[model samples]
Target: MEEVSTKPSGYKEYVAGLLAGVATVIVGHPFDTVKVKLQKHSTEVEGIKYRNGLHCTVRILATERVRRLYKGATSSFIGVAFESSLVFGIYSHTKNGPQPQVIIPSAAFGGAIISFVLCPSELVKHACNKAELLQCRMQVQGADLIVTGMFPGGSTALLRESVGNAVFFSLNTDSSDPHNLTDVGIGILTGGLGGVAFWSAVLPLDVAKTVIQTAPDKSCQRNPFQIYRRTGVRGCYAGLGPTIVRAFPANAAAIVTWKLAMKLLGIKNE
Candidate 1:
């Protein structure tokens, strides 16, 4: 709990983080909605619901239109806002030294902290609960949805967060000279590629997380490796396309908001 406190960075960093969260939500929710849908539904009903991310987007637009893309935004807004604030607040406090050794572990710690928050938010975003999760949506007519049910796949989430964030924040090593436009250009290039690396590494875990949380069959194995065996490599990478497309702009907006908020708060970038 103390890890989430905004005491470090004079409480301003957390405020900046909240702004960044809103920015991320605004820029990323549609992609996330698609990702969640694909993770949960792509393999259902003979795997014909969505051919790919673009096809999924088109089908949603064609049938349910634009609003469909933002299906879970309301719950997402609260969950992501709080989760982002905690992550950035924790990161700012820990990201003091610019060395890879320092930044990576610190970012990993922040990621570990956020996983607890992310798991439950994931449950809500996917309309999954212990009871609801054990029953298909069609069976939810009178099935009790236990909001307080078991938090599924917590360890898997921890793995994804720690590994993904280590890669995500390591791209910002501070030793580089800003005067060298070439270094900055290289930074941009590596950052984009590294972002892809981060997603590619963890997205399978994410797909597993969704299954553990929302699988309608109670007998479906809760283990991620077992889930992987069932889902296969391609199945687990279900939402990679939209996620890659959204990663660039959405995270850019988050960084922009974080920097702008810090500036407005009269804090120096560390």
Candidate 2:
């Protein structure tokens, strides 16, 4: 078992989180492409029909080849990098309070905080989603407001993130005591489960967020409930298949990378 020699406290979480975000984007972007496709068009009666995540993956590979699946990868990489760093950093930082007690609340607080961050990044990512290949999503946290109109799906983002983070952190692990998690394997399992819980809880909100953010026209209906009424219950979970599948590996890889990065940086998870 590899042990992290240096247990320095302060900036390590953000650094480790940075690495974790990179891993997440690399491992999960293809699935995410499938997910976004499904979210955007799965409910449609006429158009490219993606029966499921696998079908979508196959179709994209067949038509556009692998590159098509990673169309927005560049922008996704940058946005996810900042979003993920803040996710772990803020959540972990707030978790400094009494263990177990503050875990979920801290996660929610962190989620709420980063909701502001992710809204614009996500907007840019999705706004240019169907546009030219690999649009520059380098709009940092602050510049996003003016660059992208006032966040289109701000409320939905907040709901998904706050609730999602609470569920994700709660299931992540009982890691308050290091002894509880035997090793990295356990951490990976718990972390993956956490990710699953997060998506499962908030996927509907995600579907709404995607639709709202990617709306071509502002006059288009913005209400999630209205969408649900129009599309029905099944439509709300349009991309559930890909999201569930991506949840495990993407987040498992993230947790493992986070731990490994911490080891390399001479620190430990907060």
Candidate 3:
């Protein structure tokens, strides 16, 4: 029987994920800020508030100064860095193996593993960005007192991407080459689908997360789940459309970047 060697240590993967996160934030924070703001303050004027990503960017830069545009960048630096570290590290290693099914579980596990660091940072950043996030909205949510709000937000991301990837790949094609254009396209499609699926499945959790993360210091009488349920289903997934749009391309970009980095470092897998 062939020997099955042990997978790489979690510590190494964690470091990779963190590094990727940091790199992503540095390159993408400005766009991220604009994306968040548009999602948060969506309006129904003549039907819609903002036209598209470009329009939103133009408006924000014209009005909200480039500096203020990235208000929660510091929090993002921490949150995303940790989140990506485990995500990419585990994903790259596990998916490269024979037993591909491990990818889903590993991805989910990676998300959970890194939540200890990600959740807190995300809570702080999202809370801090609440005002800017909902600038045009009338009754904006607050972003304070969110220590306990970590579970749902943190866990859902894990559940979404990890499980989503697993399910997606299972139903999709079986490609051996990650660098092929078709393979990359499939990855993008799978990522976007996964994002939508995750968002849909955990919209309620996200809504509560948004509330808690945004309003960290509020003394609300309602339970987190209770408030989410009351918002109706659609309300929970308020940003679902944009999120899906972002995920497909954004994650693909990250994957491409990581792969390029690996090649540069002379790393290869059979």
The superposed Cα distance between candidate 2 and the true structure at residue 266, in angstroms, equals 4.3
C-alpha TM-score for every candidate: 0.72, 0.74, 0.63
What lDDT, from 0 to 1, does candidate 1 have? 0.73
Clashing pairs in 1: none
User: Compared with the true structure, what per-residue lDDT tens digits does model 3 show for residues 1-270?
Assistant: 434233555455445456546656665677667776676667764444777788877877787778766777886777677567666666656665545565556555655565566566665556455665334222333342233444435554444445544553333323324567786676556544544555556556556666654543336423556765678767777777666565555554554444444433344422
Error of 3 at 182 (Å): 4.4
lDDT of 2 by residue, 1-270 (tens): 666543336777788788889999898899878887877776755668788778888988998999998886987788887788888877766675435678888888889989998887777666565653223222333455475565878988998999998888777644333333466777778778888989888988888888887765567688888878888878888867667899998988787777677667655454
Give lDDT: candidate 3, residue 70. 75
Best by lDDT: 2
Off by over 4 Å in 2: 1-8, 33-72, 130-148, 176-182, 216-220, 266-270
Candidates arranged by lDDT, highest first: 2, 1, 3
Tens digit of lDDT per residue, candidate 1, span 1-270?
Answer: 112232355678788888878987898888887776777676756545776778878878988999888876887678778887888778888876667888889889999999988886777656743545445643643334454344667899999999998888776544333336664455455545556777988999999888877766456587888878887989999868877888876676666666567656655555
Best by TM-score: 2
State the local distance difference test value for candidate 3: 0.56
Alpha-carbon local distance difference test for all models:
0.73, 0.76, 0.56
Candidate ordering by TM-score (highest first): 2, 1, 3
Better of 1 and 2 by TM-score: 2
